[model samples]
Target: MIAWPPKAAPRIQPIGAERSAECAAIHAASFLHPWQEADFEQLFVGPGTVADGAIEEKEERLAGFIISRIAADEAEILTLAVAPNWRRRGVATQLLAPHLAALAVNRASSIFLEVEAENAAALALYANFGFEKVGERKSYYRAAGAEPKPALVMRRVLL
Candidate 1:
C-alpha cells in the first residue's frame, strides 16, 4: 500500500506581503478563477484575516495555501489552494493543520468554508478534518462555458 502522508513534509509559514505574488501564482495554477495579486493584498490587509502557506524546501516554491477570517467566535475560510503538482501529497493537510490550530487559539468556536459540491478532493479533505455539511448554496460558482455549480457550506465546531 502507498504511504498515506508523504515522508518529506512541506515547510509551512505565515503568509505576508512578500509572498503575495507566489501565492497568486499557486492560486492561478490551482483554480480556474484565480485571485489577483491585488486581491491577495486586500486580504492581507483585512482585519482578522489569517493566511498560511506550504513551501517546497528544495525549489523554494509555494505548494499550497489557506486563507481565512475570524469575527467574534466564528471563522470562515475564504480560499484554499494546492498546486496541481502537489495535490494528493499532503500539502493541503500541512497547510490546514496549522491554520486550524491558529484559529482555535484565537478563540474561534466554529469554522466554516464553502466548497464546490463536485470537488471530491476538497470534500474529502474537509471531511477528514471533521467538517460537516451544514447548508448549500445553489449555483454559487460559475465557470465560463459551463453551468453554475452548487456550493456546500461546511462547518466544524472548535469549542
Candidate 2:
C-alpha cells in the first residue's frame, strides 16, 4: 500500500489589535507602501472592516492576512499579504476562501480591489477567483524615484 501525505489545512481567524504589528510586518515585506500598526488597529475594530489571518498551527505564527471594508452592498479589499516564507504555497488561497464567505455574510453584494498592473501573480490569483477587470487607473501607484505604475480595478459579484 502507498501512503500519501496529508494536505495542509491552515487555520483562519479574525485578527485583533494585538496582532497589528505582525500584520504590519507582513505587509511591509510584501508591498512598497505598507500600512502601519496603528492603521491595522483601527481596521481591526472598525465597524465595516474585516481583518483575517492565516495561522501556521504548528509554528503558531501568522502566514498571511487579508483586510476589507464593506459599505452598504459593496466591499473593497484593502490589502492581501503573505509572509515571505509562506508565499506561493497556497496561503493566499486559504485566506481568501473564508474571507469571501465572511464578506457575503456581512451582506456585501460585490467586492472590488485594485492590483498593480505589473503584479502578474496577484492578477492571476484574482482572476482565478472570478474577478474581472472593470477599469484601469493610470499612474495609480507611486514608488520613490520610480515612475508611477497603473492599477487595475477589478470587481466580483457574490452569490
Candidate 3:
C-alpha cells in the first residue's frame, strides 16, 4: 500500500537555540555537508538573524527550516533545508513565508540567497517566488570526494 503524504499542514514557528540539535539533524539529512548544532547555536546568538522551522505536530518533528540575516535594508537567506521525507510537500515554502514576511515588515528592500547551480528543485522554488538570478560564485560548495560546484545567487525585491 502506498503511503499518502501527511494531510495536516505543518506549523511554522520561530526556532530557538533549544531546537538547534533538531535543526542540525534535519540539515544533516538534507545536505552533503551539514551544519552542526554548534553552528546553529552561533547563528541563534548572532544579531539580526532569524530562523523558522516547519513542525509536523502529529510526528512532533521538524520537517524543514530556513535561516536568514537582515542587515540594513537587505536580507540574506543563509540556509534552508527539508527532511528527505518531507521534500516536495511544501515544507520549505511554509518555512520561508513567515521569514520573508518578517523581513518585509522590517523594511528590507531585497532578499538574497545562494543555491547550488544544479539543484533544479530549489531553482524552481525560488523562481516561483519571483527570485531572479543576479550573480554566480565559482566553486562555492566543496563537498568531500566530489568536484567543487558553482553557486547561483538569486535575489527578490521586497520593497
Candidate 4:
C-alpha cells in the first residue's frame, strides 16, 4: 500500500467580528480590490444572509479562508482567498466544499459570480470547476482611484 502524506487539519468555523481584521487583511492582499473590515462585520451581522468561514491551520496561524452566501435558492461566491503563504495546497478546495454542498441542497440550481478579466488564475479555477460565461458587466470595479475594470460573469448549474 502507498503511504499517503499526512494532511493538514482545517476547521470551518463561523466568523465573528473578532477575526474581521485578519480576514480583511488577507482579503486585501489576495485581491486587486479588497473589502474593508467593516464590510465583513456587516456581512456576519447582516440579516437574511448566510456566510461561513474556514481557517486552514498549521500550528496556530490562519492559512486561508473562503466566504459565501445563499439566498433564495441561489448562492454567490462573495470571496474565496488563500493566504499568499498557503496557495496551491488544496486549502481553497477544502474551504469551498461545505458551502457548495450546502448551496446545492438549498435548491441552488445555478450559482453565479463575477471576476475581473485580468484575473486569469481565478477565471481558470472557476472554469475548471465547470462554470461558463453567462454575461459581462463592463466597468464593474475600480482600483481605489483608477478607472473601472470589466467584470466577467460566470455561472455553474448545480441542479
Estimate TM-scores for all models.
Answer: 0.93, 0.93, 0.93, 0.81
Worst 10 residues of 2 by lDDT: 1-10
What order do you get sorting by TM-score, best first?
3, 1, 2, 4
**Candidate 4 clashing pairs, residues 3+ apart or interchain:** none
Backbone clashes counted, model 1: 0
Q: Residue 29: error of model 1 in Å? A: 1.5
lDDT of 3 by residue, 68-136 (tens): 999999999998988888887887777777889988987889999999999998998899889999999
Whole-model Cα lDDT of every candidate shown, in order: 0.89, 0.90, 0.88, 0.73
Q: Which ten residues in a row have the lowest lDDT in candidate 4?
A: 1-10
lDDT of 1 by residue, 85-119 (tens): 77778788888988999999999999999999999
List candidate 2 stretches off by more than 4 Å: 1-8
Q: Candidate 1 — which residues are off by over 4 angstroms?
A: 1-7
Model 1 C-alpha lDDT versus the unseen true structure? 0.89
Angstrom error at residue 143, model 3? 2.0
List the candidates ranked by lDDT, beginning with the highest.
Answer: 2, 1, 3, 4
Q: Which parts of model 4 are misplaced by more than 4 Å?
A: 1-9, 13-16, 144-147
lDDT of predicted model 3: 0.88
Model 2, span 1-159: residue lDDT tens = 212344356699888788899999999999999899998998889889987899888877888999999999999999999898777778788889989999999999999999999999899999989999999999999999999999999999996
Whose TM-score is higher: candidate 2's or candidate 4's?
A: 2
**lDDT minimum window of 10 residues, candidate 1:** 1-10
